[model samples]
Target: MADYPVTQGTHGPIYHICPGLRVNLNDDGNWELMLRTTDKRKRSSFGKGEEAFKKAIKAGELLALKLGLLQVEHDKERLLSEVAAEWLNLNRQRWSGTTHERYSQVVRDYINPKLGFLPLSRINRAKVREALTETAKIRAAKSVELVHATLSGIFNEAIDLGYTNENPSAGLLKKILPPKRKRNLTKPDPFSLKDRDLMLEAAYKHLPGSYPLILETIAFTGMRLGECLAMRREHLDLTNNQYFICESIRRDVIGSPKTGDRLIDLPEYLTKKLGAHITRMREEALAGAAFTDFLFPGIQQNAVRLMLKRACYAAKLRSRSPHDLRHTYASSLLMAHYSPVYVQKQLGHHSISMTCDVYGHWIPGEGKKNLDETLAGQPVSRRPALEVVDKKIPLVAASGTKSGTIY
Candidate 1:
């Protein structure tokens, strides 16, 4: 046994066991590392041994450096929830309102419940994997992915702030989480042109005031339901037979359009109809009707959905969602021999591959019909260019008689 420099503590005398480290043996006979920096002290037990004391000193110094305690006092034992809140505050301005809200929900529902209490330093890859495994049990794979992403974002921000060394959620997803299954490649079931026409006609006959026109606009221009409901008179360009899709409304919060701004061309008939609807809206507004900037004035997404549901029922048609109207528009354009690039722009898809991925099968030459047509044309000759003939040749037998053989 060697004498070590010792300091007095409330429990007993603590040993100055290593450089920038101290140790105290507790009543339970456990050797605890008493970490002393310039501004604060922390205690951690790594069991009773000279070896354990040395290892604890090394680990504590590394953590202290990571927490910036070497240069200044820092809250090294921050909970995951605290880091998440800081992350949200720093990034709230960068993300759209919907995106921020979605991320907030994921943190509150998934990450906070499982890992919020854990200290930032204690949250390693295994801890994150456990959280993800638990989340996967009850949530969809996509939800689990979001949870993973939220945690990664928080830890990454923590890393940049020197609060932690690594993002535990990084790369663990592919290893521990189940691979996301491929989405079905089948073309979305949208209303046929005839069915769309029938639905529109029935809507006009059954629905009250401007609802049919709203449905018609969605079908004519591949506008999302939110974008349609967010439209104001300023968005319409009747003379050009086009409208600008620049903003959207969700839960009464106005924000940028999902895929950014785009211009959508409308048919002359649709343009005329929209013009007439606007004229009537102005008259109604002047006549003391409820005024709103929305083209569909005072209608929200759910109201529009209900209107569409009733219209479909009245049309004696299969029930279709409001989104199905957008689908109908894209499918019809693709069926009319329109190029995927054109369709992508018209629908405001972020990428051509996205448009092709969803409606590629609807493209005339990209479906089963194309395969049938390709095989129906002809079979090219694949015969060999050379021919050989069989001839008889003389061969000697073991019995010394000549035998005839084919060569």
Candidate 2:
């Protein structure tokens, strides 16, 4: 028989019974911790002091259980890897394929290998911060945020399952800031009016068949490389003068749009170019040349990039990329005074914020025109007048030369 602690019940001093540091109530109950008062009768007479000791001991037992040194009624300590697996299992079906693949890789590559040694309850905010800060140095800001978010969710799940009472990552928001991401500052070589016309002329001169038409379609439509490459014969509708953007081909795998939307329209010039390319393909097939259903098949994506690079070189222009064609398209549309919301839909952006974030800078260089148009759409009180004053008055004579007189 172990010493029982003198704890006060409602009436008076009650000699409470407990054994060792942890007492198992029979074979089935929450383990009760034991602590004896130094002077049982005296502490009991001093009022609720004995009861306070029992409460403190009970709380201590719960803390011990949470820290994984002791087991609770039914809950067991969980390994970090086990928790991560559970997290993935719960979220796998809810996330998109692209999203699920990325989260899985992050957990496997970063979180598990580094933190797997610790039990879920033992992991603390300091450990989580160290992992995230180190990852920021190696990966992009967006990736760091994603990994942090995933880990946070996992820990939250552990809390819900009673593996731990509190999430280690709960206080992380105040402790960590996402690293500032460096924008891709190098601008793509934008095509001038003359440069674009020259490239069109060269394509017509050198690749008179389908290739020229394909180039024209890409230049005018601003379709993504994968989207343009994925175009099939069945997707075209010359009578409607519209080419639908329904799918994309990535690494030769055909799939629906990343934006999850099925359709966008191509401009009439792009439609005509598609028609011409198709006509050329038919002519080439008749002349002992094989063609594919894919409008731009058989050409590797790298080859497309390389070909575009060479064209830029030939034009004596700075190196450009296939993606620049996309910028060119968006810049042109925005310059034409088309609505950003409309452009967002065409580009399949989930939010107008993304459209503005990526392409908003392009509008500022449009020489105050966009600002004026935007301001016009506002309520009368909000709209400000465009003020213009001549900063300098040139001294010109009748002969159209500078006057001899000076102030």
Candidate 3:
């Protein structure tokens, strides 16, 4: 290695590893990392901090490659595309078909085209970041997230198999990607009470048999659309006005509901409505319509979504989706001062934090009502203290003096 020059600065020494490559320590007493390709034509970055030093090390390696100081790849390294495919195929049994398919699509469309050609050892955080940044430019935040996850998954597999030692895509989404504009945070997506009513009315008139009932069930209970579709007559308890929710439909497949199954409470009105609907289903079954054990036969998620849109249009209400009805149910509960725990149970959420994260904005950030007014509290009731008396006989006290009284 050639000897690199060093210089003293106002605060500390500047270590010049080579031309256009320096670790600077200045008045702030922190390391400043600056790196550029030879000839100083391509300056990559200038940053100050311990993290900058780490990034600089990686950047400097890249600069070294450009300067002909390092080889790009060795025979031992495998191309990232090949590694990714191997990683995905190996996990096929570990993931659901839909999950595996989604990840495969992400890798094919977003990840492989960009970083797949590089050797696994040569891939770094900057390359992953650039790919994700490019994805964000053209894709929605959600799609970007999927692309990021696919990359991270591949890199993780690489580490476990000893193909690479670092995970370049780790923490890249949260730390590097710009904050997504959360529409739910700005304004709750749940429909208004009037909007809900209008939509139900429109669905009843314009939609086919049991379509309105399906929407009503979602509106009254925070049941997911998938769960609603998967429901069977046995799942209902009309007497208790509760629905036993366990299974859900997804991607035209019956499966367990998200977060597992829990019974959902239904209002008495909805229970009666379900009772009549079931009777109607029985009547249709006798008349020759195909007998479907499901509560809403032939209605799927996409169909429910379309139903909501049509209802919204007919009612002249703001458009929404089936899942948005779930949101509406939660918002109604929050507005009624239902505790987070209750809402969490009703929605079958995994955690209280998740419940709050999605619907916290609907809740009052500050105390909105005085305790007296809200609770109808008054001075606590009290009973009178019991009276006590004591008597003592003095008959023999000082016997001579008490003789007359004693007798």
Candidate 4:
């Protein structure tokens, strides 16, 4: 062992124990080992003898190198909330405003409250599942699912940044959480064809101005209220008899459409009506009306919904939501034997399964009729009835008198 110079300090003696390593005796006479390697510096105590202390320092350096902690100069004990904030800031811009707001709110309301203080490395699957289970008590299963997804996204970002090795929230939902209850598909209560006609007629009669046209457009095109409200002049092409759906409005903020852009073919009658509507809008614009770009002009979704409700009442029809008009459109298509794929594309659903899952019951097909026909060809058989009467038969006797009689 090389004899190194020991520098005396106020507490005790400090020795240059090795290259990149030091040993210091504290006021309490305990020995501490300090290690400095590349970009990292860490210190710990090694109890007693000089020989034992040197061995401890060597072992510590080897462990730190193996963990890759020797080259990384970061707080290895950073909390989950710190990493989450970084992740949200980096990724929120890619999402729509509503989606960003929703993620932020979920993180604030559910996740951060439960697991924020835990160190990133310590946030394991069990901790994540426990938090979700607790959240499920007061929030709906859907809300819990959102929380789980958000947490998983955060951990994934942490992994990319080398803050953690694994996403604790991965597969946690399936392992510990019960499946979310299926939505009650019957609740939407889509308007039937008769009800639709009656409501449109009632709207034309009872509602003022363009309210009826708005309802008609939604029913005919199956456009969502936001998309309908957000429509503009450039979106329509009368020559091609098509309308482009590239954007939607929510809370008066225009954004990309939910399922991206699509071109919808319009019926001739609708094309003509829309052309007249556009002409009227142009005239209004020239006459110093509000200089808004929206095709519907100055109408909001809530006002439209209120007018729809009154129209349904006046028409003696069951009350229907504005969304029901969209449902009515899809239902009519399916009832006419339109292919589910066609319906899915027309509705701009991201997947055909979603279209089928929601509207499968309305799609026309053989249904139970086929089963009925299969059973209809079978023959029926009947068995004879039994007859009963009071009767007695006896045989007789050792005397050979064959004397028993039945009557």
Candidate 5:
């Protein structure tokens, strides 16, 4: 084993070299030196393992330092657009099609147009703020904010990959004016007791069997439009009264959820309705000498939309989109006084906060009532104080012992 002398540094021991060979002076007061003939390729960390060990360790350390310096310089020259493309490609497999499509759209429509040609070093906080505000002028404030987030996330990836030291978009806050909140979009839906009956009657009179069942299931269960459309015979467990939502049908593609990775449980009423629909579907299939696996097969989503429109129109109700039925479900749950946590899980929301954000308003004067109720539940002590009254005697009966004031 060849031994290499170890010299003490500020924190640890580093290899000591002879003064026979020297390079340019480093940041330290002493001269930066190197061994001229050492094979940088054969370098290793061991300084005392064999005859070649000392020379190898020295070569490796020098080569590694040179590479690190080169990387730092390269990072300084890297552009934001280049880093962003690399980041998106790295994460593409983990993202869903809709999500990836949306991100690509943002990059093409917003990010590239403004920041594509600019180097990462040149993109400062002020430039980002300007770009964000410009977008807000063209689009809705929320949309601008979303683009800001998308761009920030891309830059953040660059930081993580060692292409940048800091994320320039990290601390920039969105400059949004207060927005006016709107009433529930589902309020016009004919899902009320009377309206639903009328709508059902109209649907049965005009539409075929499968259509009515499809619409009713969406309204009843608050399942997403795609989830209801994608159901197969295998997905439903009629005997157990539950269905597993492993896949959804969106625009002809059998896919997963937008939020992704969730299994929703169906209520008993929905389970029975689904069972009945499956039975009716089987009867139709057998009578027509045809077999199908889909619960709502042989219909496009656009056709379903049209049917819903016609039903709402014939029932003398305002037209509401299918997604609104999901909102109606959420509102109904809150109005029925169901726990937010239960509803959140049923809806496959990532968090209770998200459920609250969407359905919090429908909770019906709950905030103040909750506060009052909490105060009322606490015990408090009560106290009473004694009181005295004074009466004056009449002056006319001053001579009388009972009426006279004593001197």
Candidate 6:
């Protein structure tokens, strides 16, 4: 190795570490790596010696290829999978477990299977279009759309890092004609008061202890089932008929609530019922019942959903998930002419527009006296038992709120 004359920067003097790599011990005493190539100058901090030399060499290779000194190995291949792995790692902390799982599923099952092996440059518009077309033949429209989004995101990250120049998947969605299918949630299917009573009655007979009351509380309060399950003794306020939503349980993991902390007010009837339930739990604990961490401890979202299914069956009503009770609460208020803004706060939605977008259909038509008429009044004729329900729901276009809203 040959010693070179020191070059001066405001930080410190620069010294040669290798052929294309130089090092500067900055005023902060940190080793700064400077890659010397054509016209571009790249500087980064890496700890000293052999590790710095390796990183500098790797960076130097990229700089050389970028500056046209060394030919970029198109024939040797830089697969998109390589860039994708880096992208996922880079943004792993930003995504939740459910989100990470979904993104991983799309990548592993759809995107990687078709485009993983291809060089990033080779994944042109035609190739992407063909791949989407093939996938559309097998998957639903929404699933195919997710595949397209995953490809676009991967390609975007790669382009940002200079791994590839163009995003071939970009703007191809307008042209890709995926399969047409029904959307899973056309609108919120909230239960009527009569149906609520029927289900609660069936819950008393069919479900285990406290579930009947639990269902009513969810319908009355608009708290998410997860939030309800995460309730603790300290979260309750019997005097005010309300509870504080500090945390939520998702996929068996306890974390902060979706919309942060908020107070959920309940009807007086519900407040008394919950208070009585708490008294019962306390009495049970005193009589040798195991102490529980949460008010609704020893239960999971799946078990609640399964129990709700049984109650729906026994009530001779449509099978509604536990989340549907939230819809029931929101719709009940809306039809009663409650303000959407108030409902937004109660539902823990980020904004009024989201509540409106979801529950907009629940807003009563002009001159309607009771909101119950809309969700209720299903024809009394019962279909054959054990018959598959294939009826398609129609999507209602939101026309915004019709009447003046109260604060």
Q: Quick one: best TM-score, which candidate?
A: 1
The C-alpha stretches of model 5 lying farther than 4 A from their native spots are: 1-83, 96-98, 113-127, 134-142, 160-168, 176-212, 249-273, 276-294, 297-316, 339-341, 351-360, 363-407
| Per-residue alpha-carbon lDDT of candidate 2 for residues 1-407, written as tens digits (9 for 90 to 100) | 21336654443333333222332222222233434434331111111344444454445444434454333322456778788898888887786554666677888898876565456765777777877877867876667778888888888887787777777766564355533454333445557657876776765665423455555666777667777777888888887766678777655556666776445667777777678778888899999889778788766567677666666666566666777777677767887788888778777788999878888887765556456557678755676778876566667999999876544
Which residue runs does candidate 4 get wrong by more than 4 Å?
1-85, 96-102, 108-141, 162-168, 175-177, 180-187, 202-212, 297-320, 351-353, 364-407
1-407 per-residue lDDT for model 1 (tens digits): 21346778776667654456666777776667666767767878788777676555455545545554433332447878889999998999999986887788888888876677556865677778878988877876677778888998998999999988988888887875545555222235689888899999999999987788889989888899888888888888989999999988877777888889999888999899888888887898899987666787567788888988898898889888888888888888888778889999999998999988787776655545545446756433443446666666768899989876757
Task: Give the clash count for model 4.
Answer: 0
lDDT of 2 at 202: 62
lDDT of 6 by residue, 1-407 (tens): 11334678776666653456566766776666677656557788776665564454445434544454433334455777778788788878897654666677888888776667556765688878878988978876677789889889888898888887888988887676523443342345778989988998899898997677778778789988878988887888888888899887766677777777998887888888877888888899999998775778767778888889999999999999888899988888888888888999999999999988788866748346544554565432432347665765454447653544333
lDDT (tens digit, per residue) of candidate 4 on 1-407:
22345778777766654456666765666677677878778777767777555555455445544554433433456777788888889987899865776788888888776677556765677778878988877776677778989998999898999877888888888765555555222355789888899999999999998889899999998999988988888889899888999988766667788899999877778889988988887788799976556777668889999999999999998788889999999888888878888888888999999998888877646155456446755432333346776778677889978886878
Better of 1 and 3 by lDDT: 1
Q: Which scores greater on TM-score, model 1 or model 4?
A: 1
394 in model 3: Cα distance from truth in Å? Answer: 68
Q: How far out, in Å, is residue 362 in model 5?
A: 2.9
> Candidate 3: misplaced stretches above 4 Å?
1-89, 92-127, 138-142, 162-165, 179-187, 363-367, 371-407
Clashing pairs in 3: none
Q: In model 3, which range of ten residues has the least summed lDDT? A: 376-385
The candidate scoring highest on lDDT is: 1
TM-score of each: 0.64, 0.54, 0.63, 0.59, 0.55, 0.60
Please report, in order, the local distance difference test score of every candidate based on alpha carbons. Answer: 0.78, 0.65, 0.76, 0.77, 0.66, 0.75
lDDT of 3 by residue, 202-279 (tens): 899999877889999999998999889888988899888898898877666676777887987899999998888888
For model 4 the TM-score comes to 0.59
Q: How much RMSD separates candidate 5 from the native structure?
A: 18.5
Per-residue lDDT for 80 in model 2?
83
